[model samples]
Target: MSIHPYIEQAIELLKAMISIPSFSRQEGDVAAMFEDFLKSTGINYYQRKGNNIWIRSKNFSDQLPVVLLNSHIDTVRPSSNWSKDPFSPYEEDGKIFGLGSNDAGASVVALLTVFRLLEEMQQPFNLIYSATAEEEISGDEGVASILEEIGPIDLGIVGEPTQMQMAVAEKGLMVIDGIVKGVSGHAARKEGVNAIYKALPIIEWFKNYRFPLVSDLLGPVKMTVTGIEAGTQHNVIPDECRFMVDVRVNEHYQNKELFHLISQNVNCELKARSFRLNSSFIPTDHPLVKRGETLGLRKFGSPTTSDQARMPFTTIKIGPGDSARSHTADEFICVQEIIEGVNTYYNLLKDLYIYPV
Candidate 1:
């Protein structure tokens, strides 16, 4: 059992990254540091777009299929409830604590370490390692901006805090803004349609209606009415009602199709924010999934979205740390977790063979 020799350096790199505040859409400083680290490792030909940084294997061959190893480099702005400075990295027991340490810094540095090792050797498929920005806010400047340069990818491994388990299916996010129209009138007159009253049934429909297609791995499509604005005052029957829906779609349907179904059922005028991040699922028979099964990793569908949402390819999400610890006041990832992440990632890719996608 050969262990990753540079695990120590990987941990140090994560610590260094945590010390810098790489908040979403504001990762210029940390991106520069990441590039510096790559240069130090003799990897100087990395492609940079926006704040995302990506590099391919030195012996990258166009003939082979490409496997993209991706993780985000951005953290959310620290909430007002922290016991320690969020930007400061510290260690306690076997855990490293700081912002972004668990959510993705651990995975980013682990993948970079594995990339260094893989570049020194050779794999069945070409490798592209990327540390992307703006995952926290799901901004356009992140992984989405780099795909054109990295070219086609057959498969992607999104590194997130999944406790080393495999997320074969991930829920996609779609926000819908809705408006219900009615005629305004004085409350005493009782002669006008109340928009707020009109919206109740539509909101109830979102809560009760179920999509026909249900994914076995991801289960049902979930939608919630997260926000609403209706009445102008107590005396007047408001003519317009606006609401926001947070939809968690399964891979069984596209966002646009789901929107059409909902709009047909509800009386409100509906508009989907964007259909780009529709739900994603990799087949259980996919070689990547089958490969992880050999290592006895448990498979489950993730309700949360990650950088995987941006990759329109066959992808799996797996990494160290616990998803529960991400964005907490005292965020931490075990040092041992990073060590195992490197080993597991290396084992998964060391001999991976790509078939037609």
Candidate 2:
């Protein structure tokens, strides 16, 4: 009932996590830190081979299904222009400033704090606190392993920074790579087929490509050419040109259909050269979303992807901190928002476990 002690604990945990720089696959140290914290709390937990940690409550019961609270432990590479050291935790104007503070460490810290509180209160439902890795480049290894080992679950809350709003749905992502081939020759000779020139048509097509607008709980789908590279020298005609495209799809389009459209419509050599594609994930609304909405949480759609894509479960994305602040220099999250996030998660657990009627 006393929130002050819990808030203080949350702040301490956030400081501890920020003190360590766990970038993507390099999360062993922070994972160890979390494991030690869970052990100190006397909770049952273990570390997988990939260094991902999972902690469970001992007071688990069958009345309420098992709930998995998930967040990534890794952060993107630190920016070079931080006012303070990226790894050093600092407080300014009621906000915590650090590299991963707004990106996801805030949520991880809050979740761990909530887990400890739940352990102390002896919560009824089987609770799992999962700090996963490799979320930035798709969570193929970390979340996949957890799903394969732990099997299916009743519900999952993806602790992504949504500024404390409830995200019931997110757009599915498709990553496309286009390779164009051409003849390599001296630039002085006009006889060479320039690959960069070949790629220009496709790039132009993309510029004018009209993406279909599909209305769903989350609004319209979008396509963005995120990366492009071609030519090794200024005077030589490039033999190969490669570019990457990110397509955000809605429920109206299937991955297969979208890939087909890209392959067929884009003016390029489809056989010898190539196009590679990767699909996104969609999580349907579950009982947990409904219950959280009743608790005064605002619902919205997410344009980005998360670790939820790598698993098959009734997943919802919720947490504190602004998405705009994420991955930016001087990234930060308000101390007050972190406290509110803890209370929101704590209440969510109580609703699902204690009052499931």
Name the best candidate (by TM-score). 1
Per-residue error for 204 in candidate 2, Å, reads 3.5
Query: Pairs clashing in candidate 2?
Result: none
**Across residues 57-161, which tens digit of lDDT does each residue of candidate 1 receive?**
889998899989999999998888889887888899988999999999999988888888888887778999999999998889999998988999999999999
Per-candidate Cα RMSD to the true structure, in Å, reads 1.7, 4.0
How high is each candidate's TM-score? Answer: 0.97, 0.82
Query: What local lDDT score does residue 283 receive in model 1, on the 0 to 100 scale?
Result: 90
Clashes of 1: 0
Cα deviation of 99 in candidate 1 (Å)?
A: 0.6
Candidate 2, residue 95: CA error in Å?
2.6
Can you tell me which runs of candidate 1 are displaced by over 4 Å?
Answer: 1-5
- Candidate 1 weakest lDDT stretch, 10 residues: 1-10
By TM-score, how accurate is candidate 1?
A: 0.97
lDDT of model 1, residue 63: 83
